[model samples]
Target: MAHWFHRNPLKATAPVSFNYYGVAGSPAANKICNDLRTTRARLLDMFTDITCTPEVMKNATDAYFSLLQSFIVSPDGSTQDNKMRFIQNFKWTDTLQGNAPRHVAQQDMVFELVSMAFNVALWYTKFASRLAGKENITEPEAKDVHRSLKVAAGIFMNLKEMHIPRLITPAEKGRDLEPRVMDTYIIQCQAEAQEVTIARAIELKHKATLIAALAYETANFYQKADHTLNTLEPECSSKWRKYLQLKQHFYMAYAYCYHGQTLLAGDKCGEAIRSLQEAEKCYARAESLCKEYRQTKGPGSTAKPSEQLFFIKLGGLIKNTLEKCQRENGFIYFHKVPAEPPTLELKASYGLAEPVPFELPSLSEQCTPEVYATFDLTRGAKNDKAKPKEEEVKPVKEPDLKPQKDTGCSIS
Candidate 1:
């Protein structure tokens, strides 16, 4: 009986014919027939292993078939009415006749079939949403859905890739090719699966770094923009400090990119690209840095990004500053006066006994022996004539020079 049922159940059943005015060999017929056949086969296989009473098996089979047929006819690809009809008519649990193994298998098969059908219905809803021009989903929602799908796909793909020794696994040893069918099923599941978190993590890490770098670069660029707008020296250190702050932030941004790139290289190509791209943005900020420095100093005082050496070295800073000044003001030239040493001049007082005649050197005559002799001879002659004559000295013999005594006291 089991052999007969397995071989030709349809032939054993009573046949009924109904005439319908429909195209027998049209594209629509082919499409519909294929869908119907596939759906029927899936449901039949799901129930085939059940060890149930004949009536229970018949009712369950008829219920599944009717539901599939209704789905085919429904414009939306799913109908609540069809689901309700299946639920009302199909008593799947009753079909298993106290056979634990068969009951569990049958239940699992039914659950799988129902889930597949539900997925189809959901897909139709998504299609409807897209058709209505309402596909502008939020980022969070999209990310959530994408993440879910990726995870599902990754798991299924992993399962499909699993290899087993044929002798060790029961399914592998079976000649019925159930293992091969299971592998195919896993592959199909993988095809519709979502991406994995590890992959996403790698991708997002790089993206985040890129965004941060972009922000830092943008802020740095804007901070320096004021340099071009102002002409005078910055009154306070605020602008300079701001410029330095920008540079510091930009450095940090680059650091983030570098770190992110390292992390991404492991398994995150997407993230690595993002981080590197951000680093590029930081490099572009050089222009803005120059502009800001020039604004505070002068148009010619613009500093290069690579000119950090000047800030660190004393002489370099002075030289660069001078060079910048010269460039802005054209050639720099100055006439400096030589400093003189201190000296003293001599002058005679008018209270002197002899009128001292100032002797000055003759400008035309050169100092020689004849000039010195003439001046000395004239001076000596004058001194000799003016010599005072000493008269005969009258010598008076002083008798006695008496000592005078004090009036108050007698001479003691």
Candidate 2:
């Protein structure tokens, strides 16, 4: 499963000393700054170990952000005037655009919030990948894999919708915080989550028609995710795009191969043969992409997807089923094959994945009024003067694929 998802490394950041000197403030602010520095360091370190429990990461995240809230806004909902007073420079590297560090010096803490959240989302994806890489995942591990992806998707959406808009400075083009990058992350997480559902359905021996529909929908997700990156530099995105393209083609083959099985069950031998032929074509395209994926330079672990058991199984299944369909058609009904492949089922009534709803935790108890009052709120930061208006990030719109007839058993 590590090989299944293309993950960029977690965004890197320079250490924040959080030193406040010569400024008039309560002594608690100093303790708060120290807490901020230590807690953030712990959270960043946790990401280095994919095996770190989510509970630990969540605790560290809460500890840091609780203290951080005082810097952004007060409990009264008024934007803090001293937001830009924190002299510590927060530097973060863009996950996709390039490796160079981008720094925000006393501009706004919202930038820090957005950058950290992005890294946290990346951690969730890496955690999911670690769970999936297990040689023999138990049922619980499978569900964890699915749940982790949904959480990651939710985090990405949360940042896009809530935090990025609050930044005093807009994210630069090709940066990780850019809307296009966020959209790609959201869609890819969702598609990968649904992949788990498809695998579960197959293990449960659900109906071929149902599985085909789910696979078809999953392929569309991968295609959509890839399309979001189409305008980016080829060298920067080609490797990641190749993964998406391969998954798209591979799932299309999965859909057609399973649809062929369903058609055979219905005694429609000619349509079955056509469906299998389509499956063969898609599988061939995916195979080529697999080769290309291997050769392409990229960040993250190199995966030989073609060598995976899942890939091997699908190739075998398509070959076997196509032969069976052709053999039965010749020996028995001798039905004429359709010139075009039959329409695949588009609406799956069962086993589609959705992102888990997510919201940032409320400001921590450490952000008391006494602490909030320590920072001067009289003068606006220089950066806040005549800020340029930026385009609002549009919410991601998803089509409502209403469930059709239940062609197979449903998962409760």
Candidate 3:
């Protein structure tokens, strides 16, 4: 643990000690001093446990030396002053003056330190693995770990900044305040955070199918709204139609891309390439339609900023899919074929004079007898006109027939 701390000095500080400057004899001062002592004790205990391992000792020593060097080169006060100056220059007086709340800042600092430690550990681990002749971790695996850490950090940061009690108001002694009290900002932020958390969780769990389904549902809802607006307001039909088309295409493309990625994972390169190509085409069409819609709206028209962001996101997805395909040596070519005109052929008998003029039948008269008899039977008859003689028929003998009697019941 000390080795870890030494490698990352930021991690050495207790969470509560961040920005805990206290006046003498103040409660804050006491709290900070106690926290510092506890942190030191924990580090000392961890250091003692690794005393038998020389390699661990050397790592710890290096970490300590690096941290000491950092302190000697640039002290904490100097770093704080620089940060203060930067924030002040940006007119972030509230943050500088401690009015932004210590917990939020501390949480952010803690997350930053943890992030740094993770990266350092990752580098060290990779080096060690290489020396040990172990299989190397893949880029995607590394990315997944990093993403998980970041998401965890985000959750912690949110927890630190959240003020549940403050956001809720007590009802008056005789009246209900639930209807009147509302923290719209907090509610919106929480809702968005939940969405992000759920999405990230799904990704981490490898429930990509679920994620795709959710995305499809969201897109469909938006498309339905667009359709509803168009139906209710005919004058804005064109705008809504474009909006609906863009959303439908974007979602469908996103779904295709997700499925393509799954195929790529399964080593179906050809199928993946085709799916990704189709997805790219869909996204490109969506972007073009969005641009056209914006242009049609004219200058000074207040268009939603999200429309442009959607295009940007879709473009990024397309580029990523293409890059992935290229990296895997999976590429496909689409060719355009030109249409050829129909050819007509005519056949004539050599013995016959140039075919007699024939009238084309009208649609109603197409199946008439005149059309059916166009090929005269007499023309193909044999050239000989001799008559044949008929033969006389002889009578044949017939056998005699006998009748039989049937018995009947008297009761009938």
Candidate 4:
């Protein structure tokens, strides 16, 4: 008899858990929470329909992209391209109702709109990455990369400097927007946006700008997020901490890859090797934390199927990215060293595999090479043949970091 998945008693998959809830007894917060819950359910349904109804998948994806594109072109997200757009296009500025302004509600939609753009960008970016450097990279994949980058850039430009609406206060009541404290949401959006920006920067050979942006974000988020987490209440605190830590480690790994790549772009092989080693260390930490935080829930608990898949795929992606980075940086190693966090005990998680060996293409050769080939930023060197090379950066040794006891680096 042929053996199936169930036949192999030794093969077991671990469960993952997730939950999100609004502040208890607060109507305003409750409504927003309900809206978010509905949104998550609806999006998952749409995705499922697309999967089952393959005949309409392309049409659905196109419509989805168009909706995303409409918002991308309009940073304010005040325009209404589709009736089904997440944010309702309300036009009642300066009108007052009892105590609050009528338009006050609209101010908060910026976060939601930016979030929508971020998700769409993430989806297409993954699609593009899967197809990248493949033997059969079709027009669809190339188009996905182009559209994804556009969305990512749009999200960054729109939200990079945005402030958190002072609407969400620590107390039950609202307060005036604070100017001093950084907006955690925007910081996160911008951090994710850097993935696309860094790739584009490498393609354009602007190593200085890429390194500067990555370094700034990594440091900024670590300091700010660490401070925010210290002030959180007990309820949902651990959940949110896990969420933020995931992003923090991701940014660290991301920075390491580009830092190494920038060195390689300048022919600093030794430095690039060291930077990649740091990246591997970061990835291992992230992998362990990811599995630990989302470890299997006990019986009778419910989590969305789509959400689970996303987390699983994300775990795989980090491993894949690290493997690619190491190969590209010319690192030769035997076994992939698994770095465990000091806090997490050995635990099982979904979709994490040992980093497989693969050949990564040159930085410029991967995605949309024509984007760089057809463009000239310099005034005098408009001709293709006279294109200037980026100035080679000298190799510099980064001071090795001592093992620190506190690993609670994250943004709110």
Candidate 5:
């Protein structure tokens, strides 16, 4: 049994006591905050279970469903502009300490673990669903995953709504608090949500048009969620630093892989190869970060073996697929190793243990530009005026106007 399991076994199923991080005025705020607290606490309990039986897993899914419900937005939602008001507060403290570190609490770490597990569960559900007629997964396993997805979609939709900070800005905030913190949470949630979406895509790979649609959605979501985790680095502790490093780079790499897949689907071989190469590079860094975390933190606290394996296989698949892309392209390019890996930003800035070079090119480079500049006559004239003049400017000529004689018929 894992050491974590011994902490409290029966409490795993007990209801969590909901406490406020700040004052929530409305019924909607109270319900959402209370529910979020309960959900996080419940997840923390299940994460410690060494024997995560099917029954336990089912319970976890149930709890997730309840929590997930709180985040969902209805077109005629009762909680409009009310639930997020408290969370949008600048002085909102989630812990007892006035200036507590973001990742200090057990629940903070466990919430992230829950997110990872939830995504893995989504994959398993879709995976088992695809092979439903086949012999791999039992009927019960398929049912469990299906249920998990129904709940997970709630979380994914919530993340989607909050993809931009403006989306989460509760109309009741009265005054704008520091939105940076909440934005980080939105980013992390969006990334995990996209990963779950990708897993569904992977399971449906046999359908070409469907695969293309999924590929586009996956690539776009991942592209958006990428690099947003960088905000969590300075404000977090070592544990969060490690988790962020592993997740951020891994998803960035995963996003690139999906993009490569998208390109390959479109028969853009050379572009696909370039994207896959970028994926290869980011995955390598993710691998290194994961290793470093294990070495320093011990293998005690992390997602279960099944969850971890999905990403491991994903990394390997990226490698093999990348090689395949290169071979089929009829060209191979070797990347030159930098003399010393570029200094990790977390090391210098936050003093996080990670030295892995995770900073890389963004994948949003693939998106169609919505706004662009096109210079024409006015812009050219402006540019001409902006040039440094060695001599005085000449006076402009005014248009000539001739006076005309008026008809005298209307003398009155």
Candidate 6:
């Protein structure tokens, strides 16, 4: 199962000191700053250790975001001005922005919100991958994998729709928070979550037609995700796009193979034969792409997708089903094989994955009104202490996001 999913390394970040600028130092304010530093460090450290459970992550994230809310959004929904935003500097490196530790920094708290949320989303993906890679996954573990992916998708979508718009400086192209990368994360998480559902359905002895439809829709999700990165440089995006491409073709093969079985049950031997033929071709193409993916130079940990049981099962199913269809057609019906393959089932009526809704926790108790009132409101003065110079970010070559509509599946 380790080979079932491809994962990029987590984005690196610089530590924050939370030094207050032009403010009278008080216990509450100092406590708040110390809490911010402690909670943020805890949250960031979780990424380095994937074995941390979701409950631990939630508590750490909640503690950090609760304190962070005072800097950006208040408990009562009041918008803070530039004076509050420019008080602290936050820096983070992009995931696909090369091997060096080059980072982009901003004197804006909203930027901090976006970068931290992005990391949290990535942690969910890593958590899901860790769960999925176990030698034997139980029913509860499978459900955990499914839920983690949906939560990850939700966080990415939340960053895109809510926080990204509020950033004082827009995210540059190819950065993790950019719209294209955001869409890629959202789509990929949902698609992988659906993979769990497809596995469950197969185990439950669901109809071949249902499994085929689900597989086809899952393939569409991966294709859409891959297309979002099309405008980026090949060096930055090629490996990831190849991963998506291979998964797309692999699920398509799954669709056609199960579809052939459906057709066989309905006594459409000719159509079944043609469908199985298409399945074989798609599986072969996926196999080639898997090899290319391994050789491609890029970021992220390489996965041997071709060696996974899920992949191996499809090839065996395609071979056995195709043979059965051919043997039955020759001895029983002798129906004419059509020139074109049958159209794949476009949509699955049920079990499609949807992102869960997410919102930051409320302002922490340490950020009281007295502490909020003590901060200086003027932006004319800058922090005299030296800080990391902001890196020059390249303009994005990405298009506007065009997210696919979900089937309104219940994530509960």
Error of 2 at 153 (Å): 0.2
Among all windows of 10 consecutive residues in model 4, the one with the lowest summed lDDT is: 1-10
Name every residue pair that clashes in candidate 4. 15-296, 225-410, 225-411
Q: Per-residue lDDT of 277-343 in model 6, one digit per residue for the tens?
A: 9999999999999999999988877887787766888899899999999999999979999899999
lDDT per residue (tens digit) for residues 191-279 in model 3: 22222332343435445445445445534544554544343323323543455556566665665666666666776655666667777
| Runs in model 2 lying further than 4 Å from the true structure | 79-88, 97-106, 377-412
Candidate 5 yields a Cα-based lDDT of: 0.38
> Cα deviation of 204 in candidate 1 (Å)?
29
lDDT of each: 0.29, 0.77, 0.33, 0.35, 0.38, 0.82
Q: Which candidate is the best by TM-score?
A: 6
Give stretches of model 4 more than 4 Å off: 1-170, 173-182, 199-212, 215-219, 264-270, 296-412
Q: Tens digit of lDDT per residue, candidate 4, span 1-412?
A: 0000000000011110111121112343233334444444344344323232222433443433332332223323345322122222212211002122222233233333433333333333333332332333344543444444344334433333342332232211111122211233333333433433433443354654355345436435544654554454323234334445655665566566556555556655455556556656766675665665456321111112113322234345445644564575455433333342111111213111121121111221111322222222232222335533432322211122222221111111
By lDDT, the better pick of 2 and 5 is: 2
* Model 3 stretches astray by more than 4 angstroms: 1-206, 297-301, 304-311, 326-412
Residue pairs in collision within model 3: none
Q: Of models 4 and 6, which has the larger lDDT?
A: 6
Q: What are the per-residue Cα lDDT tens digits for candidate 1 across 328-348?
A: 334332212113211111121
TM-score of each predicted structure versus truth? 0.18, 0.88, 0.29, 0.33, 0.38, 0.91
Q: lDDT by residue for model 5 over 37-106, one digit each (tens)?
A: 6655555444434344445655655555444333322223444432212221111112111122121112
- Candidate 4 contains a number of clashing pairs equal to 3
User: Which portions of model 6 miss their true places by more than 4 Å?
Assistant: 21-24, 80-82, 377-412
Off by over 4 Å in 1: 1-234, 298-304, 308-412
Query: In candidate 2, residue 88 scores what lDDT?
Result: 42
